[model samples]
Target: MTLMASDTSADVVIVGTGVVGCLVAERALDAGLSVLMLEAGPRVDRWRIVENYRNLPPSMRLFHWDAPYPPKPWAPHLETRVAKESEQYLQLEGPNARAYLQGYVRYAGGATWHWAGICWRLTPEDMRLKSLYGVGRDWPFGHDVLEPYYTAAEYAIGVCGPSDPALQWPPNAERSKPYPMGPIPFGPGEKRLTEAAARIGMMNLPAPQARNSGVSYHGRPPCCGNNNCFPVCPIAAKYDAATALPKIEAKGGKILANAVVYRVETGEKNAVEAVHYFDPNKVSHRVTAKLFVIACNGIETPKLLLLSKDDRNPNGVANSSDQVGRNMMDQPKLFAEVELAEPLWTGVGPVQSSSILNTTQGEFRNRYAGAMFRMENFARSPLGSAAALKKGLVGKALDTEIRRLSACTARLTVEHEPLPLPINRLTLSSKTDWLGINKPNIYYDVSDYVRRSAKEYTVPRLQQLASELGATSFQLSPEFLNSDHIMGGCIMGSEAATAVVDADCRAHDHQNLFLPGGGAMPSGTASNSTLTMAALALKAADAITAQLKHG
Candidate 1:
């Protein structure tokens, strides 16, 4: 099929309008470079998403964080509400396929639209896992190199975190700058957990979050604690890409929504010359640029590369190493909930406010993966109320049950660091979407390292913590779950033979092409990876800026 004569041109062409892509656009545009961002999903407003959540049937609302933002036919993300329902879109196999059923939105701003806004930085030790622990591969650069970018990202997204150095996570990574604002006040549940954890020799610190704590920064209002952060922040308190698009456009960057990128075209020297995308009408349009960046997360970026095959490079663009969709990693997660003998009143503030930092590091990492534990701050109202009403309780009994569960129930979650394995990967499925693009087929499994960590350390520690909370009944999930922190698809390395991108996030085969974000991450530490992904994006932006200046 003949594509339309180069539909448009720009200094930089970016695929995926997620936080990483949008942040890069902001930096590139600020540096006076014209950028064209193509998003496969529709451009939705905050109000629309909030209304969608409100209109959902009461029963579905609790598990409907990613449901309200339905997938567009052209660009589908994993539908995780139900496995059987989502299988038609994402083909899953292997032992841990169910855990890989992630919850992410394809719309502009991507998954951050429904994220809890937690931000954790990797320690220098995390980057040197192979050198320090003899386990995973080491990053080309260390945490110190990314620290500046982390600081920049925190300010860019208006992160509020602890000012005390002791309270910061991954304690070994020194900070050059304090957070933009002081930490958000911990919820009642977090306070209770912190006290209980201290008695048992655990350290629970306030989590660094991207949402504004008090004073508004970057035009976003402060978080009002509406407790609807997952589906969508009722108000624009959290930093989502939607809040950045207008500013990006104000700086002359253009965004084309509902533009599904299908193929990447390479020219002389195997450099990325252009990309082909399908519009909402299924008409093909070729977009040319001097430089191109694919920040479509772990799955879609590699899928696009595999789809773009040619004689000069038959193994897919930038996949000379055959690592495009390989080494996919996520923090295998477990949840432990208990009915406390006393009311803890968990729904006081943001969804998640604090976590135990003690177990995230140690010499034990050489044998088993590390884990981070946190108290889920979601108010028990919606879930408890719904369950009570379903039990056929009328007025007084219903109110009593709801109050008891909402105030007394406490939850703890353990997120484990999983070692990267080439066998756990993503491929193109035989099934096709409305646009005829083949859906993604993924095979995933949590390594024994993580399983061992849960069995030996995290689970037992969590059970002890729950017991210390004076729980009447406590139970931990039997199986590992996906934490939604996707990483290591287009992994970075020093050698071109083993990695798709280099330390600078530039494709080894295509100098002008970059695949940043979590996809370029070489390691998945036990923490929320959004801040790390943003740091990598900023680091890549600096390299792209320098390349444009010299060339």
Candidate 2:
């Protein structure tokens, strides 16, 4: 694994080749800037991951979804499916340690490689949480400023959603453009749940997805109802950052894989001078650029900034305000397992199709955190077998019971939005990894706001929804889990003293450093933050373009 180091300079250099990083690199290249991307993890082929997933036994498929994508020693990521392995990567403490066991992989394509591809947009109400509800902090700008970028991101990612405005989430939110393609029709289980939810005055809307619906999009095939978006998507129907790598290269953007960035070098006027990285062999290399963007994961972004501490930035890069790793946020999740008399016949389409979007906003936010709900559409055959086997049934009785439970069981989910708190923080751990880099130590409390919401508001509503589904028996999961939507580490604000980045995601302390994507999000609305992250990436690119071209 011997590698040579040479001086490489570009107009803009980005760290992390995830969706957000790729989006920025693509835009910078399209704007005729020499763009270079440094990825800590090795490049993996999608087909190989798909084959690995297909080789798994049916019993292990659902449980070990991420087993196919093994972590390389130099580039390790948390695998929550295995608690011990997860703890070794991310040191977690606090009252809700299990909830903070964030599951993400370090690969050139980024976490999008194994994502559900559901893109939930933040509403105007979400941006103005403080003004309207007097609970959480408000965004620096309103939804109107971000709408165009959202639309652009949707088109770039090839998203498909319902054409009818009434069927869209936040039905009243104004849109800058229609969806790129029509939505995928709901399956039998989704249809039945929709009807039941409607009777209870809940609207289940089709979630905008990064997967192609019917016809092929951007040279990618359409989804064929495999219900296997997790782990791997066999065909390129779903939008993964890896799929954009070739296009980026075609546009003259160089991607250096297996190059982990550990430091951000600063120079005169507090501008980013260059970035130093380590190859898999621990060979150090210096990459200089006029401008730099570190689009690493929410956890890794702050960790990198903190790791880059120098004489000038003793607290950390962009930590003059001492908020680089503060305000950690994620959508806290709970589950409800229901047994119904009639078969829901789940797993007809994608792993997730629709969710109760209306519950995400309201006046109730003044008292408790708001929530969003969804019915997981993962194939239930394995769960059914596991459940039926526990009953001690044998022979034909076991087979019959499996069949009944497979079709009759449903898993409903609720994600309660968390307010940003400085206490929910990530710090450099004493523990070190293979590369001797400090592992991330996180302190997360689901917070009394989320606790009260689940206890007083969300739990009762979830039970009410379950009752409407005609459940013969229902059990609610007692513990809170992560939705894997990480946010707020590098929080954005208008003023420099209170926030790490500006609205455009430029680091407040460094003129040439822009930290975009999930880490820069101010508020983690009760939905997937992937779309908003992509939009922020694009918006940051626009700002970078203006600076480089106009100046």
Candidate 3:
């Protein structure tokens, strides 16, 4: 990517260089508009990240996945695993504090660098939660409205899904076009779970993923089952936003890293006049643009908006509705660690390849939350080695113990869909970062809807799976955990008084400013939300292009 210049004027200034902003920048540049993207974090090389992860300390490698990319002094993300209040960049408190301990990083690519590559699209029922299930807010439009954009996002991101429509996530995804590549074959462990789940009347389908299966697409190679997709991908097979930066720059889009945007300057009629940011050295810089889009994830996006307040907009930039940071949501999750009678042998493919999706949608949503389950495919060598070393085992004995433990152990996860609660809010913390900006303070609770499902619907189903898998030892986590699929905070709706953004993700308070991605999602189903976020980004790009061309 080209260097950032002193001249920062552009037609559009996007506040985060994650996939959302990168896609928006690409579309605006394609429309011949001058695009400038300001990223809070520093630009990093992919190879460098891979090497850093490879050489990290054993403890850090096992526990601290974000250790590879240390946070910049100004662009700090939630770093410390410790629950100490003083050490947190994102101050989380509620009935479920552990549930909100997110693992996102402040790097050039955003969180996708450490993702499992799963890409599940939302079903029609997922969008119309209020109308169909009598609970939660519904999307402004239906699945038919988002179908084309979903197709476009899948092709742009090079998604691979099952060839058989019956095996698709939405029971034959309503696709205008087929997947770019067929599904990756499941490993022995995945196949075993698929078969067992089927006998129990559950459909465990192959997951639609972004990484390639056997052929190359858009210059990236196919996955070779490296099984270390958590910290780094090692190779450029999986999709990451960092890979999109150079292409955006090649098309005349300017990206400024280490530029921590703190204020959104508004002028007459609440139009976005400019945005001001502080560099790592704490020197502030301001840039003017005709329009602005804040594509920082759910947490950071709301934090940035709350920081930008003026006499005309006292509550915050888009607080005319007082909804900038309300309605925080996530797919609250639980894990079940099981040991089988015989070796199950996970880690034969990507970190995740299939899931039991039948539970994600049902008529039972009126009572409790719907949940989905998956067996994690992370290689067990590190965990096995740790277990073996603790026993004072040596040499061949150590190797034998590690081998058996890794092969026989498995982790099953239950991710429950959550409702957008007004109480689950993200506000500005009294705590300040190294740049003297207020950190994000979020109060999160999984709520009774999710908890009811865990006790009645999901936990029972998990027990059945463990029984079917012939688990000699079974241990389910006591509390709900964060699936890392953050949503809400800046909710969307038909009324300007209730929602932060409009149907096109444009902020209601400021016509020229758009707030897209996860923060604007009204509902998040029991699946990975990244693909849905990408579809929304492309949709927002269309609106931005239209405004630039005709308005």
Candidate 4:
């Protein structure tokens, strides 16, 4: 619902209605503080997105998940499917330009609307990268500090995974409690891959997913194996932020959709007083609050900070260290398509049910990056059918080829952790969107650390795994694809000179402002970074609660 003029002032003003923002709002409202959320995209419903998918042409439907959730012209996001289209938003530069065309939907819910729902927590060692690995910076605190918050985030998002410690993703990290729901059973493909990985002395664990498993939890339904978790979940079995908006409203929180936040206005003592946003018709509105937060993902959060320059902070708000839009990161992934000799039946469960955790850490990280390998559990029928038809095979021949490829084809991906580099960054582009807001331009390259991991560690291991599966052909990707876990633009550290935010994700330069999300992550571990981002949000929420109470 749109916020009225009287609702302008709040205890907390959150920019972005994504999962991170929604969680923060939930906690702050739970503390009896009023919250006003500003979202750039329109409020959309599940049925509308499902119908949009159904209305697409067969070819477009096969590979174009982004087509269903078309971005509002005023709030455009990255779309790789049609990179040359009118609303190609994210401006890419550097040699690895095309690789950064991330597919995150800009709607009321944000990217969680289309995520695979795999939630992997960061390991204790992952937090202390500098002390242990000597590669990247360490977090201000360790896993023990964030473990309780991780448990809270899992329950908040309705995550289900194996209770067995041996079956956990980071098999070494101690768990305070079991997952919210029972583990999802392994499918035939996951079972086969697990066996194959075992032969190579690796561990394949059932991935912790935010989707419900057997029974409904937190208002979401159980997973029915619809296999449509990419573009949108047809059922409400998966957790997304859209589901949280109404709950926030019911608790006296206000949300304004199609409210594009442009500038952050500072009042005194390096405090964020108010924010300026534009409506869909380019009508400007200002909302003031005691505290402010920017949770518009990694790219937009940094871009917004850079755009909010003022007299005291001429460089930008909270950018005294020049760390607002620097040290950009994403998990650079390597793809391998194997034509196995046996049928795997991959589409029996969620899009990503399991992953090999053996390569995620070791003493070898000092030289190269860590890798997490997993099976791409998307159904191969439509993809195989489309490819066969395009090759002039029709009727019986097409049917035979489609069945063969669908049953035997298995795609494996290895996600490598790239160290945060100041050179790899995002800047406001000279070009502007329809709203006259400067677009984000990125310069990124997977450093040689990641390349060395692929060459020395992951590639050889993937080949061995493919051979163990008795593959006919194993083809490796020539270039890296993004895991879409954008991170490190507004990095967290103990010192103000080196980091944008502190351990609590509160801006070091502005005590009353917080930038909590993947962008606050200091190191981009090989796992899906959502759980860590959620945990950070919860931690930030507590900090904000304490500040409001004692101050």
Per-residue accuracy of model 3 over 311-361 as CA lDDT, tens digit each: 999999988999989998888889999988888989898998998888988
Expressed as tens digits, the lDDT of each residue in 1-551 for candidate 4 is 32322347888999999889999999998888888898899899889989999999987887677888877888887653475654568888887775577778778889878899999988888888899978889999878899999999999999999988888867856787899998889889889989989988988989999999999987888999998898888888989865788888988888888999999998878799999999889989888988999999999999999999999899888899999899899989989999988888888888888888768888888999999999898888987787688899988988899998899998999999888899888899988998999999999888889889999999999999989988999999999888888899999999999999999999998989999999999999888999999999999999999999778
Can you give the TM-score per candidate against the true fold?
A: 0.97, 0.97, 0.97, 0.97
Residue 121's C-alpha lDDT in candidate 3?
Answer: 89
Per-residue C-alpha lDDT of model 2 across residues 1-551, encoded as one tens digit per residue: 21122247788999988899989988988888888888888898888888878887876676767778778878888753465653478888898877877878888888879899998888899999889988778999989899999999999999999888888866866888899999999999999989999998888998999999998998899999988889877787999865789988887888888888889998867788989988889888899988999998899999999999999999999989899999899999999999998999999989998999898888989888989998999888889999999999999999999999999999999999989899999999998888889999999999999999999988888889889988998899979998899899999999999999999999999988999998888888899999999999999999999999888
Name the runs in model 3 displaced over 4 angstroms.
1-6, 82-85
- Which residue runs of candidate 2 sit more than 4 Å off their true CA positions? 1-7, 57-59, 80-87
Query: Each candidate: what lDDT?
Result: 0.87, 0.89, 0.87, 0.88
For each candidate, how many residue pairs have backbone atoms clashing (under 3 Å)?
0, 0, 0, 0
Q: Better model by TM-score, 1 or 4?
A: 4
Q: Please give the lDDT score at residue 387 for candidate 4.
A: 69
Query: In terms of TM-score, how similar is model 1 to the real structure?
Result: 0.97
Candidate 3 clash figure, as a count: 0
Q: How many backbone clashes does candidate 4 have?
A: 0
User: What lDDT tens digits, residue by residue, belong to model 1 across residues 395-492?
Assistant: 89989999888888977899999887899888888888889998888999897898889889988999899988898988788788889898988999
**CA displacement after TM-score superposition, residue 493 of candidate 3 (Å):** 0.9
TM-score, cand. 4: 0.97
Q: What local lDDT score does residue 40 receive in model 2, on the 0 to 100 scale? A: 88
Q: Could you tell me the lDDT of residue 369 within candidate 1?
A: 92
Which stretches of candidate 4 lie above 4 Å from their native place?
A: 1-6, 80-87
